[model samples]
Target: MSIKPLYRSCDSQGASQRSDELRTYAASLIPTLKARAAETARLGYLPSETIQDLEAGGLFGLTTPRKYGGEPVSTRAFLDIVTELGRGDTSVAWVVTLLNVSTWGAATFFGEEAADEVFGGNQPARVAGVLTPRKAVVKKVDGGFLIEEGLWGFNSGIYHANWDMLSIPIVDADGKVLDYGFAMVPKADVEILNDWNVVAIQGSGSSSVAVKNLFVPDSRVTPLSRSIGGDYPSTHLADESLFRTANMPLAALVLTFPALGNGYAALETFIASLPRRGIQYTGYSKQDEAPVTHLQLGEASAKLDAARALLTSHADALDTWAASGQYMPFDDRAKVRRDVGFAEKLIWEAVDLLASASGGSLAAATNPLTKIWQDARMASLHGFVVPNTNFETYGRILCGKEPGTLFI
Candidate 1:
């Protein structure tokens, strides 16, 4: 009962366990990720080969357009990859999920020329970005906007990305802000600063970028509002309905999976470790034989199930809407918000329960459970998953209160 069963169960061929074609590819990569995860955290950057393997595994282009030699996979498939990666190294998973989301966002919003340019020569290029358009300088240029600014807290695949998306406000000649555009900048045009030392999520390499007088072409920039409004650059080529869905929902999807993975990781570790780790000074035959331990495991897994349900339900809804080519209304979007909030909350519940059950062994620096506890705590602090804040926002919608944000 010394926590070995949990690891074996994860590797078993149970259909419910995390073992499918995508998960297998992801699981096979765990040895490399686990080997480098600590180094990534200590050095504040991921090795180039780690990035290469991820791309070779087809992780970076999870949602890329199929027309561009990409898979354009489902959102659930994307989450499963994150989950498998998170099981071995939460930091790597954190970085992959965020970078891929930015990549997918770019493919969904940017024009055909832009998609080909980014994902064309590069088979699995990571897209690093920050979506908050703050303190930016933008002016109209020959063919696009001239932007010279830096983005902070940019996470996931920063060192590995060939292109970056910086959130900037496009200003007209009159100095009036025209629109909030996600400006894609080539890696050479921007400089990365290795200033990503943090408390919990240390391995993300969440560095800052510095740029001066970088001219981004019109094709590379996408107006976020228009992308959500159904007027996207991909309208001419692929179906623009991908962008027709709510931006808030898409944003929430990107945020939910990493934490969910961490929660699932904690549950799996606890369950696996339970068989060997007996209670201190208590004569329980084995931790697994104890009635109390069984209760805790069930409770922890139930919380994980709730979180997964929230994510899959929202993904199914969005997929249905995208397939139907229908413009989703506020009501449908509100459901997405509700689902995202519930999933995030459920992650904390699972993490809290599993961490409590893990006891002192889980607190060790080298233990996977330790990282899961820290990562889950940090994930809750993310802006999108701050518990009651989103719940209150969703509650207001149910009570006939108009959403205050433009996303819904």
Candidate 2:
């Protein structure tokens, strides 16, 4: 017996309008990704070939600087790629979101030489990251710091990447550690434990990473003096303003795109069912005939649209600041963060609306919407999108008060 798999595609509406040629290539890979999303969920991680496929699509370098064999796609294009991938598969989308955001850090924090080292000055560069601040502190070694830190949830796009960026804390003999710097270790140095098992986004392979007693040289990690993000790495060759946008919002925004895409995919599923599903109690033959169902679809669709706009608005703000070559002002940065938080809320709401309107079938073990709903909400609790903390922190920043949070 043979069954046709569910082949799908991400919305290319945003990508087609963009000038970047790489997006078209990346967008085309959606069906293959969609085919594997369920298997990824079942296996709790994407198999190696999935990573290889993404690499071939050039997704690993989606945000790499143009100078380093990167397409240096536009912010809109990057968002489009992410949202589309998320639409296809939450786990792949998670990998895309985390990996792209981490590489986005490299463009802004590391210098040209560093960029070249990973991207190889000829092929697209892939960087994996673990930013949860799991560090053992780095002391001054003669040439570099002897970093003995193990980062949890390293999100092994490292399986496809050449460089892995682990967060490290600086410490002196007196035990007063100063500054947060990211250590760049070659994939060869890090050990991956296939430990990513949880309620959602199973294919992310967000396993524990052990870097035991491994040494990272000074040139490997860039010293981000403070969370006060601004232009630093100065890859003068990558003069694209999008590549230079404020590091904070870029990293923060990526964390939410998968949720946005998942919500959209869920909505799409509901829409597909409406044309065929018969109402349970009424003689009505179509789910869409019910006013409540129509309202649910309309409300959920509107929320998704709003979420899209807010996320893009944040990206637009970052684009403006980077183009002007000004540090993204704290106030603007805070607002952009608020937008990210709001976007998260919107996606979660969309999921709830769609799931409720979908009826108990959404609760079925074999139904995909249940997975989408579960994944979207669970991922929203991710540190970057926690609305209460993001709202409070951004609100404080907006009110001219000293903001307290390591995130921005």
Candidate 3:
């Protein structure tokens, strides 16, 4: 059977209009998100109301194909919406970001039949995925491979997802490994393990998923190597730029937007409380009146602005390459990863500085500053945003050496 292509040409004006609508919708959800932030953390999962709002707003379909009732907005629009959501609550933003990117992957990497099953009839599908393979056993069968068993950790948004994309090793009948790829499975096919107890971003519901003797058809599988290099299986839609964008760096870059929002929120939270807060040992009745406070605030703000600039530049570069219908160069792709890590590092540094100047009381659980700090710290520690690995990868590329990591 021939796979149908889902391609629709979008003019510049239509794309811009859709982006504006998405931005407005995302902005409308911020107040609700902020109101529910504490409750989400307390419950270790997002509120049902928040999930409903996100579904109604189409926030989970940011990168999904428009032909499937998805928006397919510009990269800038996607980042803007994610950052705004993050400003309200990092955990919520983290979940939405992962869901949107995974949805995009489902549309781009899977066959048309799989896409129809997931995104047909304007249905809103929340997909959570993790690409790191662990203890996965694949055996060749007649029509597909039987996923004997596998466990994937850090399945963010799994609590709300109906579908899951898991990375697994492809094996031959003789038990010889062939290539690493993804398995698209219904959430009911796997078991969710409640083990995501963390001190930060606790509401993300990043649990582990386990599958046993599940059969994944060939149509639902895509090689990780091909997807990373922009060689997607949905080649019938080759005219669309969204499907052409590099996958690995896109995944890495999206994680930083939420951290940016958290950083901005930290700055806003600290500055807003400055008027009533006072130095513990100093005679200054108002912290805002102190000269040291001014210096710290200014430094943190500048750092945050720098991080924003870097994020914007990298996003623009990705869009440019995609629009031109060309493959992103290895160096440029590496730089995107580097930029994401650097931006995350800057955000964490800014948050730490602001938290330090906010005084010891900022550490109290009742204070929002404490949560913001913890969230930023957790976001910075993500495997994709780890500063040292990205920096080394970019540095190696700059020095005429191959990037040490395969993700780029």
Candidate 4:
């Protein structure tokens, strides 16, 4: 299906308008998404209706390159859209966030040929991935590389995508590792394993996938080291600000929005239930009238507010740096990772506070709070968003130390 661009070229005012319009569109789908939340969980993937609604709205291409008829919005705009969707359904937002960001990664890290193959004819190509180069067996071959065999887990959104963006170590003729990079492979070349059952984000359909004896041409493979801090291979780097955004920072930032959405959903659901619920063992008839309940509500609200504030601050920093056509400095980029982990921590706290106040009945599978709590907790555990790890990384950088990892 051909999707039309929402915004062609624009200044700040125009970009802001486009962002507002996209947010409004996403907001309109909340009711439908909310209604389908249970069905999505039961099916362990997004419903076709939900996918169609998103496609018709042009949301899946938010980060697609303009050359391929995509309307690449600013970092802030992308967050706004994803956060709004998360408020409706955590799994749906998570899938959209990963798919869009992976598409952006394809455009930024690869050459013109790769982009043409993925985003050709204005087609909304959904790219899903497990970008960590873990347990991949590869051999350097003539003109390209051959992935002998590998099993990759946590392949989010792969069920609905046409391509998988995988990471592998570049090897020499003697099987010596030279570098680590991403390989763009068609979905048909990989074997999908039906093993996505999990406690949270069930609708994400994050199935495990495998590949064996798959050949990737040189054009579709790019090293991670060169694309770390906006040193990308895409020719559009000079013309497109979105392509110039810091690579790892942008990738890390995309992970936190679904958690942010969970915070909003949990608060709204808990508050709406207050009038109908009571402190089961207490003398207070209505939970909202109790002092303890008030305290919990107030604290959770504050945490949610603080989380949103942190996300906005970092997103603006990314946008500002991209606008200047310069790479975000190492210190600032590390801070983005720190902020993301910290923000997810705050959101998780907020969700936990509300869940605790929800009484014992929340354990029921039918309760929305149950799923929200599980999903938020799961999102917090992601390696990039783990609060203490990111804190240590940022702290080390501040103390004149190396980041200890290549992702930064």
Q: For residues 1-408, what per-residue lDDT tens digits would candidate 3 score against the true structure?
A: 111111121328878777667666766777788889888987777899998898888788787776666668666667877877887899999999998889888888887888888776444777889989667978889888898889999999999988899998877889897888888998889898888888899999998889999998988888888888878778656767887788888899999988988888898888889888889878999998999998998899888888887887777777888889897998788888988888888899999999888777875888989999999999999999999989998888889888877899
Candidate 2's C-alpha lDDT? 0.72
Task: Count clashes in each candidate, considering only residues at least 3 apart in sequence or on different chains.
Answer: 9, 0, 0, 0
Error of 4 at 227 (Å): 0.8
Top lDDT hit: 4
**Window of ten residues with lowest summed lDDT in model 4:** 1-10
The list of candidate 3 runs beyond 4 A from truth reads: 1-11
Model 4 deviation from the true structure expressed as Cα RMSD, one decimal place: 4.1
lDDT of each residue in 27-133, candidate 4, tens digit only: 78988999999899888989999999999888888888778777778888888888889889999999999998888888889988888887774447789888785
Candidate 1 or 3, higher TM-score? 3
Write candidate 2's Cα lDDT for 116-163 as tens digits: 676673446567887755546456676677766565574646655567
lDDT of each: 0.71, 0.72, 0.83, 0.86
Ranking by lDDT: 4, 3, 2, 1
Instruction: Flag regions of model 2 displaced more than 4 Å.
Output: 1-27, 121-123, 135-137, 154-156, 173-175, 282-285
Winner on lDDT between 1 and 2 is 2
Q: What value does the lDDT take at residue 7 in candidate 4?
A: 24
Each prediction's TM-score against the native? 0.88, 0.89, 0.94, 0.95
Q: After superposition, how far is residue 350 of candidate 1 from its true place, in Å?
A: 1.0
- Model 1 lDDT per residue over 1-408, tens place: 121112111222532242246666877886687678777778766667777787677777665565666655555556666777876677778888888778777777787788778877744556788878436777887798877665555545677777888888877777698778788887778777777768667888778777777888888888878866756666644553344444667777768877876776677777777667888778885888878888888887787777776677676667567667775667787677667777888888878877887678876888777777888888887777676767777788878887666665
